[model samples]
Every structure is written in structure tokens, then in C-alpha cells.
Target chain A: MKEQDDKQIIIHVDNLVKKFGDFEANKDLCFDVYKGEIFGFLGANGAGKTTAIKILSGLSSPTSGIVEVAGFDVYKNADDIKRNIGYMSQKFSLYEDLTVKENIRFYGGIYGMRAKLIKERTHELLSRLEMTDYADKLIAEIPLGWKQKLAFSVAVLHRPKIVFLDEPTGGVDPITRRQFWDLIYEAVEDGITVFVTTHYMDEAEYCHRVSIMVDGRIAALDTPDGLKQQYGAGSMNDVFLKLARA
Target chain B: MNRFFAFVKKEFLHIFRDYRTMIILFGMPIAQLLIFGFVISNEIRDAHIAILDHSKDEHTQKITEKLVSSGYFILSDELKNENEIDACFRAGNAKLALVFEPGFGRLLEKTGKANLQIIADASDPNSAEMLSNYTQAIISAYIKDLNMAGYGNKIIRAETRMQFNPGLKGVFMFVPGTMALILMLISAMMTSITIAREKETGTMEVLLISPLRPIQIILGKVAPYLLLSFINAIVILALGFFVFGLPIRGSLILLLAESMLFILMALSLGILISTVAKSQQVAMFISMFALLLPTMLLSGFIFPIENMPVILQYLSAIMPPRWFIVIIKNIMLKGTGFLFVWKETLILTLMAIAFVVVSVKKFKLRLE
Candidate 1:
């Protein structure tokens, strides 16, 4: 593993807490995500994984924390944080009625991109995704896996410093999930940090660093193999089971 | 500004691509206007009546001839005596019964007074009232003619003239009412549903995380609807003028300006509703019950406000469309200027400001 001092830190969270009335959704969370790395946030259903991602993406305010995203404070510089981040929700977020190119143009326009740049990027993205023929087809006509791939591409279109994905591969087939991870690897290669949350244990093995959240708290966080060896488990599934059961 | 325009363009595309939305936006106004104009009417025509000529004198015969020739009464049944009047009414053959007293012409000459009774079916009170009024007018006109022909010297008369609507056409009333209803539905309901649709589909999450401000999102969502609703207002006005012959007696510019104000008010109201509603279905339900029903019932659109109960009248005073309808009636029917409707205009302006303020305050800057 690379030494932490040499790598650049993209996100810094210290004692983050989120509460909904009397219920604590996130409690005294602290972690650091390095630049150009796939940092996985893993948890079972209602383990507050989505809530943490939301707070980090500038979609929700942390109750109290020294959270910084892309070197900007989450409290004072939310709009700045927003400008440097791209987010893909767990639900499908593209307009289904719009053609793929139109959807691309809309997102580009809202992000304040120039028209000529949006046009050129549209061509490059379609060709890169091998979706040149389907560019003119409505998103509703495309298959789910293709739609998911297209959504991820759109999220990183502006080359945001960090891209937050909330269970992006949910309900996708295994082959497509593998292909989707390849796309994530390509994004990482472009020097964009990937912050992804997922409940899939096997996918956890792919992350450079993984954080396991249970009952609104991070139970254990480390490299997948380190976590497995530390738990004396054979696989990430067994590691997760031991942590959750404990 | 460019980003705002792009957002607005996308909204327009959504409206145009959805066939159901297109139909509701354009088709509803014309259909509602035609239905209100042609189907639901107050003016009586070709009403059946039974005439009981007890005297059989020349005067009674002449009066009966005049009543039949007036074109309102169709003379469906000719009754022989008083007993047949009940049978004629119960059989549903006639809506009115006209009776002349014995020696009608001789009694008129000797005592200078004669009694004629007009009996109308009161089950349907509105038409019955209309039928009675028509009969009274015809009889009065006949009396005036008789006095001119040296039949009577002195007779008191009450001359009534209907102002604004000389003929009392129902279309005149419905045009303004329908305009208010259509504008409220299109502006408020459409905007709310569109915004709530973003929330339901999860696109709002991405938008909230983006650099776009909340105000920009709201303005972009409502801009397309505002323009489209204005066009709808013009279409309703044009249809009223060309097809129904409803007059625009006041300044056309003033009328359109008032319409724009009402549209703005409704759009803000829609934004307010969307702030509370988490889904399109809930937004639609709130708009239908809260906006559409109140605009129809309490705005003095179909029912007269004076006739409603005191509490309901108080309730109507707070409704936005009530002021709008009054302003429209003043401008279109009464030929009044801005001076006449400034109070209502001020009320609508205040309402628009209040809704915008409340919605802005309630609109969450971050997802909770």
C-alpha cells in the first residue's frame, strides 16, 4: 500500500453527526478519502450509508462536523463544494423522455458549459461509450445497464473533482456490474476521486479502501484484504457477516 | 441567464412530449368554454305554457295571440278551466299557466282594473322566475299599447332595463368565469405537478447538489407554464369575442394585464404547494381540491356571492379568483377602467407577493 503522507487527500471528515429529531442517523463519523481512489462506503439497508453520502455530496447539511470536500469547508462553502462535485442518486435521475444527446446537453448547460464544448463532449462521450447509434434514441428506449452506464458518464462529464455514486449498480446484472466498475476505473484514471456507497459485499473487494457502517456508525474501515485478515475471514462476505453479527 | 433559459427549454420539451399534458393544457379551455356556453344556459327559450281564456272576450283573445306570438311561449296546451291547469302542470306539458278574468275587456273599461293570474311551476325555480318575468314584460307592453289607443287614461308602470347585458345572455356570465377557472388550473396545477415530478423521479436530488440556486430552479420550472397560460388566456378571450359575441368594453390592455397578474399569483401558489408536496400525485390532489374547487365555487363564477351564507361569503373574500373574476367582469362587461378595479388588482398583487414570500421561506435549501 502507498504511504498516506505521499497521497493527496480529497475529502476530510471529523466527528460528523446527523440527526433527524430524536433519531441519530450518523454518529461521530471520521474518515479521509484520497484523490483518484475508489473509496467504498458499505452497509446493509438503513445503516445510514445514504445519509453520509448525502452529507458529503453537499445535498444535506451535517449537524456538526469539520467536513471538508475538495479542500472547501462543507458548512461555509457548500456552493463551492457543489461546483466541484458530481452526484448520481440511487434512483435513475435522467429524463427518460429526452434523447441521450439532449440529456447530455441539458446537464452541460446547467453546469454552465459553453455550447461548443457541450457539442464536442457529446460526440466524444457517445463514441467512448460505443453508443453512437443510440445517441438519438430516448433514454426510456435504452436497456437498464446502458442507462446506468450513460448516467455515470453524464455525472463525470464536467470532470468534477469528486463523483459521488449512491448504489449506482443496484439491480444490475453481474456482467454489467463488472463493466460498470471498468467505467469507474477509467474515471479514476482521469484523476477524479470516486466515493461510492453500495450494499454488495463482493463489490467491496474492488475498492482501494472500504468503510463498513453498522447501526449509524462506522464499525471497521481498511483495505478489503486487511479487513479480511484482521477478522480472520476468508472473503469480504464473511468479514461483513462477522462485523455485522458482532 | 443562459442556464435559466436552458432549464426553461427543457421544461417546454417535457410539456410538449407528454401527450396527456398537452391535451389538458390546450384542450381543456375550449372544451370547458363550449360546454359552459352551449350546455349550461340560463336564458329560457321555447317554454311550454297553458292558456285559460275564461272570459273569451276580444281583449283576452288578443292578449293570448300576443303571448303566443312573443316566441317565448310555445302554447303547448289550451286549458278549458281552472282544474285543467293542475293537470297541464302535473303532466309536464307546460311550465306556465295564463288565466284571464271573466269579462276582461268590460271589467277593464268599467273599473279601470282587471286581474290576470300567471301561475308558473316553481320546482325549477330559475326557469320559472324567467318565464314569469317574460310574461310580465309582454303584458305591460300590451297595456302601454292599449293606453296609447285611448283605452285607459292613468296606469302606473315600472320600466326595468337590464344593464351590461341587455339580453341577459348566459354566455356573458360564463366567459369571465371560465377564463378565471382555466387560468388557475393551467398556471397553478401544471407548475406544481411539474416541480413535484422532479422530486418524485429523483432528479431533484441531482439539481439540489448542483450549482444552480433554489430560486433559479423555481423560476425555470414556472417560466414555461407562465407563457403557456398567458396564451391560453388570450385564446379564451378570443373565443369569447368571436364565437360567443361577449364584449370587451374596457381597455383590452388593462384586461390582459390583470390576467397576467392573476397568472403570476397562481404560479406562485403552485410553487408554494410544490414546496410541501413530495410527489406529483399529492401536488395534483392539493391543487384540485384547494385551487380548482374554490375557483369554481367561491369566486362568484357560477353562483352569486350575495346569495351564499355569511360564513361562505367571508370565506370567498380570501379566495384569489374571486377578486380576479370581479376585475374581469368590471373590465369586460361593465367597460370599467383601471380606476374601477384597482382594489382587486391590489389584492391580487398582495396575494402574489405573499405566496412568493411564503414559498421562498419554506423552500428547503438543502434536502432534509
Candidate 2:
């Protein structure tokens, strides 16, 4: 329950390679994510962060590598991995027709949450997001920022060991983005591992540890300050541009 | 199983929550049935006809009166001359015209013969053909009646009445078939498209990553549509029975059980389609192409499969509609017991099982 007490290795990947025919979307990728920490997995588009995250989330298979998340083998224990991990894609996957409560209840049902518990938790989730009044409102009526936050909350509603947020802050307002990070901070405080990918350099500075991918490979992996100092850059964006150019 | 139920619940929410899909799945069936059943019957209804009786004799009067009272034709006008027949028809005054030669009543007494000409406008061939056929029947009946009166020994009688549909109304045939086709397309095609839509939009990935098993997810997604389609089937059947006077002379229990079986088969097809397509558009195109046209053309619902080409007949044998239509005809028209329909039921059950099995396998492969 204490801060940094759940600092266990939540994700462990070694030499992970995801190849489609002759093209390798993720080649020889390696990383480790610690519990109770927001780990930034940054890369330009097509730099294999998505493929690696998919493999880690048990959504896809690695070509020939050892990938483990929460001690469940990516290939052998996929269902176990799916059970232990939650994913919120960049697309904000939520049923548009169903009400906010219905969406939560349906996803909760997927997580095998008991009806009474889903009810209690759904109520708590709405109140926590200040979305209690809108529980009856269909998701289509909600703003994109609130929907994004709701999607993230619902993703981790069952309290998975690790949560994967694939560009969860795309196109959101600056104030809402800040609020979204606060929600992520709260999740991290509860000892949940947060694996997030984003183009926002300011958000990367908030991560405990960060890895920048370049050209289907992990180009650099270190703390924010160390990355900035090593790359001799003013910010993570400069570090990225420098690394991407070199 | 639990996960599938949840996904099915989600599916139901998606289906019921969207008014468009509800209208398509449910509204279309009842609308199609009513349109096909009540509106589009080939039976003549208060059809107007002009009579060109040049002689104005007692026999022509009696026959024309009989024709008007037959309920199939209404005498719109009594023309004075043959020239008026074509002009009245050209003016669209009547679909048919009856012209009797001079002295029709006197000819029966003298030579026991008379010339009665039934002239119908050929512009619309369907009504013309039907008019000619009915006119021929009325003339034959009159001759037979005259013979019976003259000879007093009624050798042969023709007191013909159409069985099931006493008026031989075409709506009686269309209602059941329309319901079957609409339900099949909506339940199977729309559900499949919705399922495939989730996959395309990356929402399926979100569900797959959850604690829910793949089967649970699919079952959950399809469950609501199944229930909705069932409700649709009931509404249409009720409308057909109550509104259109279409009878279900067979066991109601058997008909319901058969309908449920058909719903399952159609839902399985939706599942199969979802597995094949990755987007709503592709799923829709496939469902429209695969189910709708085939259900209409090859099902023996409108066009008899027996009259189709040998290759088409063989193709129809594999169509679920063909079996469904047979079952409906047996129940609605023949009023037969379940024993007679067991073979078609077995085929539908097998098709349902095959689709469910194939969809399950395809779904599993996607997970793998």
C-alpha cells in the first residue's frame, strides 16, 4: 500500500521480435516496467511501440522472443496475461450507443465482475470521475476528454496488475490532459503499473523511467534527466529529434 | 460462458440501443410482410370492367349481372357499341370489357348456342390474362347450368373453391415468406456487420484484452440480437395471423420452435460473417450479397425452386430459405403435423449447427 512498495517487475521483455512476412514491426525490442511507476514508451509512428505493447498486452504474438507480463508467458499464458492486464487503445474503444453506466457494466461483465460489485464499482467510478449525473447518458453525448478518462478508468476498473495506455491523451485539451495524468498518478499510487505511449514530451518528464524507440529498436532507455543530459538536449522532444536524425 | 453472456449483453445493448438497427431488424420484417401480404396480392380487388353489350338482351343482362356480383369485377360502364370498348379501355375506365353478340337469350332457345366475347385491355398483360381466365370459367359455368336446366340430369358439376385461401389470395403465400426473408437478412446480416464493426474499430481488441474469453465475447455480442430477432419474428407472425388473416394451422409450438431454430441459423450466419469481415461495410456487402438476394430468389418463397434450372435447383437445395419456406407452407397452408416437416427441420438444424461450429472455429482461429 505504501508508495514505491509495489516496485516489482510488472513487465519483462527480452529480444522480442514481431515480424510480418519480411517486415519487422518490432525487432529485438527489450524493456522492463516497474509497478507503481508510470513508464514512458516513446517512439515516432511505426517505431514498433504499438507492436511491442500489443505483444505485452497479449493482443499479438512475438515472432521469436521471450515476452512476459506479470509472470504470464505472452504466448503460453495469453488468457492469463489478458486477465492480469488492461488495455486502452488510442481509439478510445467504448460502445457509443450504450449509456456510460451500460458501457462500464458491460466491460465489467467482461472482467467477470459480479453484478452487485459492478453496480457498486460503477457507482464509485462515476462519482470518482464526477460523472455520476451522466451515468444514464449515452457515451455519444459525452465529450471526448471525459470519454477518454472514462475509458482509462474502465480499463483498470477490475484492478489489473498492469495497465497499457496506447496514446490515451491524443487530441485532448491541455487542462483535460493534465487532469488525465492526475488520474494516472492516482492509479500509480494504488501500486498499478502504468505503461503509456505518447507524443507529448512534457508528459514523458513525469515518468519514473523512459525508453525512446527509433527505427524498430530501442535507441535509448533511462531516466528523464539522464536522457536529457546524455543527449545534450533541452527537452525529451529535442532528444527524440536528435536521436531520430542520428 | 459468463464473458460471452456479457458480450452478448453488450451486443443486445448495441442492437436495441440503436433505433436504426432496431428499425431495420424489426420494422423491415413487419413492413415487408404487410407490404407483401396485404398490399401486393395478385387477387383482383374491386376491379372495374366495362361491358359492351350491343344486343341488350335478357341473357347478356343475366351474365353481366352475374359477372358484377362475382366480386372479382365491377361493371364500371355498359357500352352501347364495340367501338366504345377500346376507347373506354384507352381512357383507363376499366381493365376488362365483356362484349356479347346480338340475341344471346334467343340463341339458347333456338340452337342452344350464343357468342359471348370477353375482351380485356392488353396494355397490362397480368390483369388481362387473369380477366380472360376468369371470364372463360364464368362462361363454362353458365353453359353447364343451362344444360342442367334443359336436360334435368346434371352430369358433371364444378363447384370449385380454393383450399386454405378460399379466394386464392396471393397475400396468404407472401406473408410467411416475407417474414422469413426479412428476419433472416436482419438477424444474420446486421448482427454480423455490427460484430465485424467492433473488430474494425479496434474495440474488439479492447474486449479481447479483458478477462472475457473469446467465446464469451461473441456470445455476449450476439445474444441481444437473437432476442431482438425473436421478438421481430413474433411480431411479424402475429401481424400475419391477426392483420392479414394468415393462418398457422399447424402446431403453434412447433412453429415457434422452428422459428427459434431459424433465428439460431441466421445468428450463426451473422457470427460467420463477422469472422470473415473486418469492417461493417464488408460485412454488410457480404450479408447483402450472401443472404438477401439468395433468400429472395432461390428460396422458393416467390419463385418455385422446382421450376428453376437444374443447377439453380441444386443451389436452392442448400439455401436455408428453401427449407424455411417449405416449413412455413406446410404449417400455414397444409396444416400438417410435425412428422411431415421433420426432414426440413432436420436440414435447418444441421445448417444452424454447421454455421455455429464454423463461426466458433473461425473465432478461435482469430484469437490464436
In candidate 2, list every pair of residues with a backbone clash.
B3-B216, B4-B216, B4-B220, B7-B220, B7-B221, B8-B220, B8-B221
Return the TM-score for candidate 2, rounded to 2 decimals. Answer: 0.92
DockQ of structure 1: 0.81
lDDT of 1 by residue, B1-368 (tens): 77787788899989999999999999999999999998897886788999998788887888888888988889988789999999999999999999988888788878778889999999999899999999988888888888889986635565679898988899999999999999998899999999999999999988888888889999999999999999999999999999999999999999999999999999999999999999999999999999888888999998999999999999999999999999999999999999999999999999999999999887874455
Cα lDDT of model 2 by residue, B1-368, tens digit: 66567777677667666788878876787778878876777888778899887678777887888778888888898898888988898899998988778876777567666677888888879878988777777766876776767744332445566777877788777877887798789888877887888887789889777877776766776777777788887898888888878888888888888888998899888899989998899999998999989988999887887789999999999999889888988987789988999999999999999998998998877764
Q: Native-contact fraction for each model?
A: 0.82, 0.80
- Candidate 2: segments with Cα more than 4 A from true spot: A1-7, B1-8, B151-164
Docking class of 1: high
**Over all chains combined, what TM-score does candidate 1 have?**
0.97
User: Which prediction has the highest lDDT against the true structure?
Assistant: 1
Off by over 4 Å in 1: B365-368
Q: Write the per-residue lDDT of candidate 1 for residues A156-212, one digit (tens) a residue.
A: 988999999999999999999999999999999999999999999989999999999
